[model samples]
Target: MSKEPLYSLRMRAAQGGAHEEGGLHISGGERLGFRDEIEALVSGLLRKALQHSRGDADFINLTIEKVEPASCRVLSPLPVSTYEVADAEEGRRQAAVLLRELSVSEQAIRNALCLLGSVNNLRGAVLLDSRSGERLDTRGERGIRVSRMDWDRERYLYWQNQHPLFGSPRIAEAIALATKVAYAPGTVAELCWSDDPEYVTGYVGSRRSGYCRITRLKEQGDFSGGRVFFVEPGTFISEYIVHLERTPVWIG
Candidate 1:
């Protein structure tokens, strides 16, 4: 296996490079060539760095030369930090990998990092785009949450009872606190987002029950179980602004 640091690997991936999933990965900037696209890559790298750096003072330099109005040249080696930042980040990454191998719950890892106190340095500004695999770099961003309504109460109950994230009673606490308005039994909360209205509704959310949930499950067999955390802010900024604006976050 390559001995390259995972951050280095991820940074390379962010910069229109290859990833483990496949090599056909093209960054949004590479495909669309927008300044925001490039900035998203930077933001994602920064977030990962912040997670690994554990709150060390750091800075990254990006040099871009315009090739044309639609595209630019990304000069190589946009080093985010030197010395302590890199070392500390490597330690954090090693810890995360080792802990995960031991079957530690993600919440446990996060809680341990929280006690370290530096991981909170992000200030709630990190936004990761799962579809495009990009991130927006900023302290303020529009955010969304998306989860398919396939997990019936039975699956939810099973997961809540058996899943590692649920091993801690704190998962219940977190879910309860995170859930804005608790749903009644047999009902579920849902949300969706889209960049274009034609592709999908700008935003859709509900707290009702119907057979449609089971129909969706029957339709998409692969996406059967998931607990999503966030959605791309740029694609759903309109909905995010109207209903789900974010506050500055230092602790979480």
Candidate 2:
């Protein structure tokens, strides 16, 4: 890839793709206020954001390359016997079987097979990473959810090590403050709890708190068994904590 500047607000309207290029109602006899209604909705959203943020505002930059709805159906629900297995290994085997039944991405399927990050945690529908979080998709009628993953070493390390969360009150407070400085509001983050145990542990957090509130516990351990994962409705990826799309911004 070549070095090029990524622009702000390069996004499309929620229903931008469905309309025609020469204005809406390609056929005649359409409602007059249709386009205006969309503009009003967008303006209202922006106003609310500005009001809530109180100054420091940034234009979210993204391009809608593709959008997919939770358009697949499962053949069957998980068997009740899966939760009753006694042995952990056996439990995982059964869960893996159930996971294979879900019509999600290969990554999500693989993670579920390995028992990563509450793979069983389904919200009636789930957003699986089919693309590198650069793609947006819908979860039933919920609308587009965004997904982005950060495997970059520099960002991930700094995210965890810089004034990292600890059990101490003062240290905890410091780490909390640092988290605010690190990421912006409405950002959902993946926080690790000390890389240990047999499996890699990860949990999700929102902008309201510096520390993750155990969206999925079992933090750090049994990772030798599999990777970590997070499940949710279509993700509304905020631009603040989002991964680097071009040159690294946080690092000098």
Candidate 3:
């Protein structure tokens, strides 16, 4: 028998209309801020249920009957006892294998799977041949780098206008600092904060990070990789680490 591929839960919002007070009225009139969250939750639950099932029938299919109140009705055509037995047996076997391979807890794996399923646009990860300097898609075909330079500039301008600290003086300083480095045409630079609110950093490289943080932006999946730019050590003298660690590493 062919090994079962890892399953992913897919969610569809119940199509319908809007209710009073500007509330969305899905099939069940369930109010949800984002559809992806519901998808993740459902996917996680199915994985959990399957883990407890004891059967050779290791699959659990779910259909969203209604969205307005977010209700799901599980569907299993096979006999419940047979399915449970097979699923539980397979689950234990898989759990043993997974435990040996993975260091993280089962919950973390489920959580990660849910997040992966919840993501609406994964922007397929590409591979760039470092030797030939060629950009290739997942299938090894030539790929194009999507340019968001203009959008980045616009966003920077908007942020500058909105923040008092990012006014003309700071903007000019930033521009001067940026000018020292030659940024490629498609390259995008952004000022972002680390997990800590107090730690702010500048990034100049590929579009992946920007694509993740900026909603309006879409990653072009540019595989045409290039050199990374960074200030040479001693370029700036400051108490903190003034120099960048390394050049751009090719992300395939």
Candidate 4:
């Protein structure tokens, strides 16, 4: 008998009437042997999307993809702090300290955290001008989508040799994107909190600081989360985006 394929689901919704284009409103997960559970999962997600969109979503998109497990490589867990916090508030304080250490300005860090807390979900990272602490629109409400970046077997193996935190494909992908953004010219730093309700650990990173993980960055069960990339003044957003989308980067 053939083994069950892994399933990935993503659902997003747009609010009705006049609304800002980039607030997340996205829900998704990956599973194994969930064929019989798809219908129920979709129904639950639809309810969430509409509710998060404020009861009247102008449109919603749901996508499901199945792939063999052998086709993907699992990566190692990321390097996390030795200390842990029991609650979100404590997590926030720790995160603040970490971001500050990375040289992220207080104002920019505050703005970034506010955006993540308010958005129902963000499909991509928001770009912020580090100096003024304001959002930088690269391509309208769509934010910077960090996808299409997967490491090949050889490259992945090479990374494994360099660092012990080179497991878990999902974590690796997140780090890869973080590294790309952090190293991009004019980028100051990055802040990210996941939208997964159960995930409370988030991270702050920069070319100088490397990646630092903080647990309890968000309230448990809080679905609002996203990423922010802080950039320097006079940054050529267009070129930065071109590099972000086209460049291949690896983390050690």
Task: Please report the candidate that would top TM-score against the real structure.
Answer: 4
- Candidate 1 ranges beyond 4 A from true positions: 1-120, 140-169, 177-229, 232-234, 245-252
On residues 92-197, what C-alpha lDDT tens digit does candidate 1 reach at each position?
A: 4444443344343455445433323222112222233323323332332112221111122243465556545334332322232223211212112221111111
Please report the TM-score between candidate 4 and the true structure.
0.65
Q: For each candidate, what TM-score against the reference?
A: 0.21, 0.23, 0.15, 0.65
What global local distance difference test value does model 3 have? 0.24
Clashes of each: 0, 12, 19, 8
Least well predicted 10-residue stretch by lDDT in candidate 2: 24-33
Cα deviation at 49, candidate 4, in Å, is: 15
Model 2, position 217: C-alpha lDDT score: 29
| Candidate 3 residue lDDT tens string, 1-252 | 112221222221211212222222111111111344456656554543333211111233344322221221111111101111133234333322332242323443343223222332221122222222222233221112111111123444654565544354322222322322223222222211111112122222222221111111112221121112222222221211111111111110
Clashing pairs in 1: none
Better of 2 and 4 by TM-score: 4
Candidate 2 per-residue lDDT, tens place, 1-252, comes to 112321212122211122223211111000001222435434543443333211222332223221111221111111111034444444444433433333234455454333334332111112234222222324322222122111123433544464354333222222332233224332232222211242222222223332332212243333222122223334454342232121122110
What lDDT does model 4 reach? 0.64
* Candidate 3, poorest ten consecutive residues by summed lDDT: 74-83
TM-score of decoy 2: 0.23
Arranged by lDDT with the best first, the candidates are 4, 2, 1, 3
